[model samples]
Target: MSHILLCFTCFESFRLTARNRAVRLSSVGKIAEKPVIGILGGIGSGKSTIAAEFAKLGCKVIDADKIAHELLEEPPVRKKVVSLFGQAVLDSSGKIDRRKIAEVVFADDRMLASLNRIIHPLVLKRTQELIEQYRRQNQVKAIVLDMPLLVEVGWHKRCDKLIFVDCEQKIRQERAEKMGFDKKQIKIRENFQISLDNKASLADNTIENNSDFSAIAKQVTGIFSYIVDNG
Candidate 1:
């Protein structure tokens, strides 16, 4: 047998290329090996609950909110945030003061937009990394992107399918209150989100989440099954 030595970098590149080709071929099949389902909803619309239901069904849910929360603790992200919003937004330990930042941005549209401009790209990058990692392990049959601004930020384009979690405004308000959000703050936050009608119009499927958890879970399970069967 002829002895062959390959450089580490070359071997790594070859391995990555092979994996990429496999992923590409699987993606092109009628049933995409891994489908990415984007979940969109306005504030307090039970998006997390819907995501949890999908998670229970074995879907890898990469929640943008959760990722954003993690980013708050990242030193680079924290530094940039402090630079933009000032040191006042930092806590005693130099970590981000999320409450202060939230209060400021929610009250100012321009400020909120500026914050998103900084954070969204980072969030998307992290989201893609998580997606690829899940795919590498073959643990994700489908990935759920639970993003509140999925429609507003045009993330819908990145999704294979979009699901809108919906509920009446009153119900949303009630839920927000129970979650410890002040009524006024909830209203202010709601004002920042796009209209439910617009989100619903863009959705491939809509799950009405006003009633019972099981009702919502049933809808999610059905939709997930449909995607896996037909994606």
Candidate 2:
């Protein structure tokens, strides 16, 4: 009986050791992998265009806004949002009415914070899962996280390098209007976000998107080269 007890103890110890070793190996593997680059910009700042340019150069691009759209469809997220914002925010299909919610929260700081509190965690969780999935696939050397609220929500910590897309407010406003956004709505959305100067200050690099597409593409390519060389 004593011999059997000793053997069981030894087996348990060995199992724990194996688990620890596996965790260490996994962590080391992640450390050796390429760092992710994050791009931050305000609304109508052409962040998607910049991300597309990087994607064209064979870089993996993860758009956080796209992820947020997907998360809104998740049942758990939908339920939580309805609970917080009331049934009026939901459509007949039971999905959150994005425009309605935006109108309510964008004008009020407390409401916006409450909404973000519910959504941001889910978004971050999904983003991390995708990053891990891509890392396991090992198909891409780096990822570009096109997040509009990167600095606002303090998501910058997830990035190894940060780039801010800078554009004049007048140009951004004109672009927003051309995209069919109501002038008042554009102004309201712009008010909710941090200033461009503040975002640029936090970023490791800045790309001005007020110029032509070719000029913006050149800036993106140069930034990518710098990250690859320095990373």
Candidate 3:
């Protein structure tokens, strides 16, 4: 519930502009033909749940954090990680242990930056590949990118449209508490990313997720309808 789930600044760390929703590809790789909608929000704001809604509505969803986890397991990536962090970051099986890496990075900015440098590019490469694949298939209706640090890391610039999930701080704090985060812990996590207001300002559309699941669903469906119709 911290701006991202910890260990995933791989523990660190959109808005749409324009009337067409998301037709342009500005990421500098092969242009994706379909709309790429980026989801933005603070930790505990139910961003993943929103992504799932889009998936259920038939969008091809890609989670950067999940992709990063896979990158850490690649043999070549492991070799580099070990070279950079030394063997202490590895588990008994010689794989890069995320918990061990997090312990080191969360307490040291330099290590965190180094770890991000090691993993982020690999994740972005895979992410872009997926985007191209989906674009090429012509079967997928939409592409939803659920990246926790999308804005902080500048991925927002590639998105055709971005949706910011806004929820009241008191409510978000309570949700974080239910997920085992105390107030101070929530603050620590939130501090790692751009402010919610800033995120909202950058988004093309904003959804207020201050209520129940059904209401959230309705809101998501509304936006989904817009994107499909507009795009």
Candidate 4:
């Protein structure tokens, strides 16, 4: 459980699920034009911030979690989510109350997997389409996959380089609290993903995010440089 607290670090615990990489084909030509960098870290590790910093340095980020959030709002996906989780997950505005769903699913592994069963496929499909589109159009020079479960979902295979954002456990808990999650809730969120050790080991580079903003920013730049130079 402590490892779950240390790793996975998912703010929304139930978002962990995946299939193998060979399932989808990548267009070499599109991504070939530019390297695709995948960001990996536990939830609340400020991974999105690192990804954003890269964007500031001029990287086209394909934010998987952002795309997943948008998918929940679509009528077709919304209807499916409601059907599976029940109308209780819907708010007065008829929107999917993500927190409500998270509370229900995160408590039970089966329920968590069930929700993943529905969401992961759709998210993956949409993500692949976007990747293909971006590749086909040759629009972006560099691509960053800002996915929370990048490794779990096997999307890491597509990455030319992987960057792991390492943050202190205490700081991560605070970030989770800021996001409205209690300690237990934060633990629940982290339960679904792989270990931090393994995640960091898989990284081509590691960015320690526990210090000053400028220090973190400098590391982010270094990673960008490494990726660009090696890419």
Candidate 5:
């Protein structure tokens, strides 16, 4: 099969099982009018902060990380996860320990892909639902996707515009460190993703987040206005 066909096939095969509350991705509706913006950035590049800035401007943000966290709490999902990673990934209360899962996945590419295969389809289904809901709302100006693997999984094609959050490596490392990730851990996570340069090149816009919040707010406002006015 061709690359595109193979990609779809891979995604299709990863759909959540019936017992796990399957979400049929093929049935999700696309938003028709307002721009669907996707954020691209390296680890710790403040993509969520950028999405929050857009939220303040009336855009609905579809946060994949939040959705994933919620999904892991579902009993079916927890069972499936245990089957994949074993009970060792669970905490004392039998809740999935995100930190333990991260440790397992980040150290091995195959394990990471396996975990994503189980989660990505569900996230996409919920994301599309939110997008359709926001599209119908008069109060929503646009939709912002703050997904970590936006470009990696080809969701950038679903976006009306892509914004690359640019920040220095030093600053990014410092931020990641503050989030409990060391330099080695950060590098390992990034190693599995597309390079920062390639992600920036694929973007329609770039927002430098090397400075204060005011600067980011100013840039976000300008870009939001431009997308709304021009579209």
Candidate 6:
């Protein structure tokens, strides 16, 4: 496994702090009326799985990457992307070639910033709309923000509680490899965002995901119950 995976050495500190915060929240009987939860984890740490578990418990999930993909399909957005990156970034069908875009942006900071400038605002607006829509619904137990760069983009500040999904470094690298991401590719993508240590430090809860689905599910269920009961 790459050393990059093991670089987040502050997990124990954050884990303890998060537990204390949870205890304080429980003792004070203070919780978000309709909690907006943010998930933080390293690549392939199963953050989506964690969000899915929350969904099963009645939380509405706002997937920023999915929204960004939808935005990329808009004609206006396509035109802007074409203007910024030129026609070479588009496929034969004229859709934005995300792989090509990633190759371009991930290799250069300025290009990535330019791309973010075009896509982020639109995604944020749509996310807010969905959040408000879900918030008004009586059955929604919580709102989960499943954004890849949640903390890097400052969306973590908007969350009522942040959950860090912890998995062993070796397991995370293997998972990312199974997803067609090589170690170098994973490192490059992660480099653009906030560190795992920082993300964990901001978390109010930690869910260990180094095991099977049942284990993760039980932990997520417990966290969901805790948030609903006391946050």
Instruction: Point to the candidate with the largest TM-score.
Output: 6
Q: 1-231 in candidate 5: lDDT tens per residue?
A: 010000110122221233211122222244346889999998889998999999999999998878888888898888888999999989999898888888887776677678878877887899899999989999889999988878766677678788999999999889878877877778777776677887887676999999999999999999999888877
Q: Encode model 1's per-residue lDDT on 130-218: one tens digit a residue.
A: 88888776666778887766655555666777788888888887877776678878777666556677667667689998898788888
Best by lDDT: 6
lDDT of each: 0.71, 0.69, 0.77, 0.72, 0.77, 0.79
lDDT (Cα, tens digit) per residue for candidate 4, span 106-178: 7777776777777777777887787777766544667778877787766777776778899999998888788
Ranking by lDDT: 6, 5, 3, 4, 1, 2
Winner on lDDT between 1 and 5 is: 5
Q: Say which prediction, candidate 1 or candidate 6, comes out ahead on TM-score.
A: 6
Error of 4 at 185 (Å): 0.8
TM-score of each: 0.81, 0.78, 0.82, 0.83, 0.85, 0.86
Candidate rank order under TM-score: 6, 5, 4, 3, 1, 2
Across 1-231, the per-residue lDDT of candidate 2 in tens digits comes to 000000000001112233433443354343235667778777678877888898887678877767777777788888888888899988898777777777777677777777777777777778888888777765687787876666555556567777888888888778767665777887676665666666666577899998898999899889888777765
Clashing pairs in 4: 9-43, 13-189
After superposition, candidate 4 runs with Cα above 4 Å error: 1-31, 136-139
- In the order shown, the candidates' Cα RMSDs to the true structure are 12.8, 15.0, 4.7, 6.1, 9.0, 6.3
Question: Whose lDDT is higher: candidate 5's or candidate 6's?
Answer: 6
Q: Tell how far residue 36 is off in model 2, in angstroms.
A: 1.3
Candidate 6, 1-231: lDDT as tens digits: 221121111111222345544554455355567889999998989998899999999999998778888788899998999999999988898788887777787787777778777887788889999999999999999999988777666566677788999988899999888876787888887776667886788787899998889999999999889888875
Candidate number with the higher lDDT (4 or 6): 6
